[model samples]
Target: MTNNVVIPSRCWCGKGILTYVSKTEENPYRRFFRCEIGLKKKKEQHLFKWVDEALLDEIQRMHE
Candidate 1:
């Protein structure tokens, strides 16, 4: 069997999983990722990434 390293999509904090949220007003229907612990600490800097941006980055990496 071939060995393959697996990578996680969650935050490095190990507190919660990545959550998908849809922006409905300013950026209607745009999807983004956030950590589940956002509700507990409003000021905490958690994972916040845009789905489109992440996809674009991945595509770029594949071509490199």
Candidate 2:
């Protein structure tokens, strides 16, 4: 069984609003997030990626 986790709509930089960009097909299956307001500033652009289920589960099992 699998579940779709809803990524929160908050930026890591404490910005209130964030936007979804795209998902990567890499081993960790990155789901990208971009800060809406931070993008305006060339240096302050904030983007992050959340790993998908498979990689997360693997890591969890390793620690067990």
Q: How large is the C-alpha RMSD of every model relative to the true structure?
A: 6.6, 7.9
User: What is candidate 2's TM-score against the reference?
Assistant: 0.35
Q: What is the per-residue lDDT of model 1 for residues 1-64, given as tens digits with 9 covering 90 to 100?
A: 2121122267657765564668667777887766778646779887677777776766666676
Per residue, candidate 2 scores C-alpha lDDT tens digits across 8-55 of: 466667776554445444534344445666667758756443435435
Q: Estimate each model's TM-score.
A: 0.70, 0.35
CA lDDT, every model vs. true structure: 0.63, 0.53
Which residue window of length 10 is worst by lDDT in model 1? Answer: 1-10
Provide the lDDT at 1 for model 1: 22
C-alpha RMSD in Å of predicted model 2 compared with the true structure: 7.9
Candidate 1 Cα lDDT to native:
0.63
Backbone clash tally for model 1? 0
Collision count of model 2: 0
Find the candidate with the highest lDDT and give its number.
Answer: 1
